[model samples]
Target chain A: MTYDWTLWIVFILIGLATTLPRASFIVLGQRATLPEGLQKALRYAPAAALAAIVAPDVVLVGGALEVFNPKLAAAFAAVLATQLSRNPWLPFIVGMGVLWALR
Target chain B: MSPNFREGAREGFRVFLPLSVGLVPWALVTGMTMGGVGFTPLQAMGMNVIVFAGTAQLGTLPLIAAGLPVWLIVVTAFVLNLRFIIFSAALARGFHGVPRAERWLAGHLLTDGVFATCLEKMLSHEDPRWRLGYYLAPSLWSWLLWQVFAFCGVMAAGSIPKGWSLEFMATIALIVLLVPMARLRPMLLAAVTGGTLAVLLRGMPLRLGVIVAIVGGIAAGFAAERWQGKGR
Candidate 1:
């Protein structure tokens, strides 16, 4: 297949997309100030965004809710595993293990 | 570097070295997905070298493969990287008199774990040079480790068994990341709000649901915090 030059452009833009936001406050220095309330709210944005990404993946399958699915089960197992151990590898090991066993 | 600067850098690297364990799975997943989804190895690694944000890179893979509009993909990435905006803001608090160019470089090198480590270890250090040295070591180490493992994943993607169900692992990775952040009541509320909304609004075109879910989650969190304050 032929190269799509726009794909390269998209790649470069994605880089800027990450870099600009990260550098926003630093570049602006003290001139720009985030609202106090907004700053508190921003604390939750990352977790919420991550949950938003994950919920659709495990809670719904093929655009429909499947509460009893293996993926969901594995996710719960992963959470439990995380709580039980501080080992960084436990979640992945437990999670994928449960997913594989159930499937 | 001065003796103080070298000592600070050593302490920073030592503190962050243990946490680098968590970076392995994430980096590998990011790289494997990029290559597995049909990008050339060069393109995949190039994306790593440039975008440098694993979550956004992974989040956009499906959209990129689906041939979504360029602007939409870029917007999605910007939203995905919004957390970095907060990170930059919080971390820049101690950088008052640092040169503009150095601040810009520091912001660009920032990563999720490195930010937490820096805040915990060196944010209050009296010397600017020491703090600078402390921040740079871990950030650079994280960056280097990510690039190395991600490159391995990109090269190994072809050999990994197809039945491994790698995509699900990516989801699991995100779940792992989210669990520690959701310990507080307000955070849990935010996650539930964002997640439920994402599911309900999944049909919205162009994956706008993700953005709405994030906003909804943040609002829910803010409201919960306010309510808790009144009860105290």
Candidate 2:
């Protein structure tokens, strides 16, 4: 099949954005120290960002509130799995399974 | 293989194996979404191989489908991935002695799960090399699984049922992942504040409201941290 340049361009930009940060640290070595405020900001970034992404998707559906989505239920189950088994993969699988079954 | 290469590869494989399963559903959903948005299987797989970031990849698909300008798509992705800048800086401190090439390889493998796991390990371990291996193993697995399953999902596009509601699976996985991380008051506050803001601003165009909520959450978290007298 022929290549799609449009898609290729998008992919390349994404790869660059994803890789550059990691590579920069490697290149800069000991010279790198994030600003104190930035580091402080970074500490809470992931959990906050992740919650920002997931909360709406879980609690809202079809422009209405849906706190009890099968997905959320399964996610709760997965949380239980993680707590019980302390296994990362277990919760993901169980959560997905619960979602699939519920769907 | 050189000793370091062997070590890194072994570490990579070890982490890759267990993390692979969790990534499959994520990749599959991303691939299906790509297909739904008119991306050919080849394009979808290509995006997975190149981007390798599940959330950002999924986030961009809607923009592409909506025929938004390419530059906007690029900008949005850049903003979404700004968190990596912080992640990289934190990780950089641990790699002070490592050679450039090794550092480059590690950079590619860094991800949310890997960074979290590795940082925790680093706090407990003194040896940078050991920390590298411990972290790289799981992240490498996650990356490999993500790409492989993404390709599979693309190839199986038409055959995959539409009503599977993979979005819900994504939501569940995300929630499961977030719940554990929100142990601190700041983290819990960030989640609640961000979630509320996202809901309040849901009507905003181009998902800008979500972005606003994220920024708000970050600021709140920063304030909370300062109040608690924690961190630099």
Candidate 3:
């Protein structure tokens, strides 16, 4: 239960580093313009980041690929259910349910 | 058209509702794991409050556990959150009318969900005030819920089963969010390339694979868009 002062210092420093970038252009005001190429490319950031986060989880079983696992199967169903359903909860329920059932 | 406050609030709740299921599991894992990594409860709470980035926070756990240098932790958090800069750059044009203080607030609170929800609403509504309201409403919901559940996680550590694998719920939430954002060709290309490359590079240490996949997918999607433009 001992508090690490160094870790707390690191956390604050990291917090500042994280916040500066997010507000960079927005706080820079109306005239700020990023490079045209980079501006266009920023459109892909959300998709790319989310994909990077999800892909490893779906495929890696114990940090290695397990092809027939329920997690993988449920992921596919969840993706498809997301495409077809209006309700947001359905895909998550379907995915988690499948994972639980198969496990 | 000015955004109806009530309307924005309702939309905010709707978006935040399903995502709550995802946040609790992540918060639990983060809170539970932080204690095991030598972080005191107070320090974990401090990190949660100051460093609100989930993936970056989770990533920090492993680095801290390995007794990595603080410089490395700072750099890892920096690189992981570089995407926030992208989010800011993309949404800045829409937010020009917002005051500097609020924009700074937006910067501090921004995340994948906030970015996605705000950008989506901006695309459809085009009213900065409405956009701001919608974004703020949900952003507040997420931040508060994250703090509470993460605290619960810290207090209820080890009570959660090892096999529960609640991280999957977080992934499912991410997938659901990602799917809606991928309606366009370039967006779809970005996601698919990122995913495939992620699988290819999963073995890399410190999830460096994620960094590579992010850059690769963006480059791929941007190139595809350019190729389509040439065709047009």
Candidate 4:
């Protein structure tokens, strides 16, 4: 099949974005210090981003509120797993299994 | 393999082992979605191999599926993946004396999970060689696992029903991971501000709301830090 230049371009750019961040630090070397405020901000980035993604998924189902969705229940299970086990994969597995079973 | 490489690989595997099982479902979902979007298994696998970013991959897939302009899809992915630049720069400092090839390899292996683990170790002043091992081991495993599961998803795509609520599982997994990290005030504030902004601005085109949410969260975090510093 002929390659799509547009798709290839998009893929390359995506690759660059993903690789650059990890590579930039090496290129810039040790002189760069993440500013204090930035460091603080970084700390919150994961939580904020994750929450921004999760809240809607949990609270809204099928374009409306479905507080009692099985997804939420499974998510709750996953959260409990995370807290109790402190294992990232376990909660995800448990949650997914629940979701799969309910489906 | 050199001791350092072996050690790094070992540590990486140890860290990634548990997460490997969890990652299977997500990889499957992503692969299935990619296949459903008209990408062949080869293309999907190639993308996984090259990109290796979960959130960015997920974010960009719908656009690709919709046959949106490739530039838009790429730009969206780029913007979403920008945070990795900061992560990479932070990690680069520790790799000063490493060979150029080794640096490249490390760069390829760097992922959110590995970066987090490495950062924690770095903050604790762990030995650099050991830190490198710890960081590389798990991410490499994750990379391999992602590829395998993505392939499986591609293979099983037709068998899985649509609207399987798998998205919810993925979201829940993220929430499970995120809640603990949100313990601090700045993080909590950022989450609330970002989520609220995202909802309020959902009408914006091309997911501009996501950009707004991210910017707002970062700004809020910066402001919170400044306020805390002044109080101290």
Pairs that clash in candidate 2: B11-B137, B15-B137, B15-B138, B16-B141
Question: Per-residue alpha-carbon lDDT of model 3 for A65-89, expressed as tens digits?
Answer: 8788888898888989999987656
Of candidates 3 and 2, the better by lDDT = 3
DockQ of each: 0.60, 0.41, 0.45, 0.39
Highest-TM-score candidate: 1
TM-score, prediction 1: 0.87
lDDT of 1 by residue, B14-115 (tens): 999998888997898787877767667888888898888888887777567656667767876887788888878777766766788988888888788988
lDDT of 4 by residue, B12-103 (tens): 67666775676776787677766655566777777888888777777666556545556556655665555676787677656765667767
Cα lDDT for residue B217, candidate 4:
77
Better of 3 and 4 by TM-score: 4
Candidate 3 residue-pair clash tally: 0
For residues A1-103, what per-residue lDDT tens digits would candidate 2 score against the true structure? Answer: 2235776887798788777865676568777667777767866666666676666666676668888777567767776886788555676578768878887
Error of 1 at B124 (Å): 3.7
Cα lDDT tens digits for candidate 1, A1-103 = 2236667888899999999988888678778878887778888877787788778878887679999999999999989987888887788789989999998
- Name the weakest run of 10 consecutive residues (lDDT summed) in model 2 chain B: B165-174
Clashes of 1: 0
For residue B64, what is the lDDT in candidate 2? Answer: 63
Candidate 1 Cα lDDT to native: 0.82
**Residues forming the 10-long window of minimal summed lDDT in candidate 2 chain A:** A1-10
- Runs in model 4 with CA error above 4 Å? A1-9, A53-103, B1-39, B59-83, B116-139, B163-169, B228-232
Alpha carbon deviation, residue B6, candidate 3 (Å): 16
List runs of model 3 lying over 4 Å from the truth: A1-14, B1-47, B53-103, B110-159, B203-208
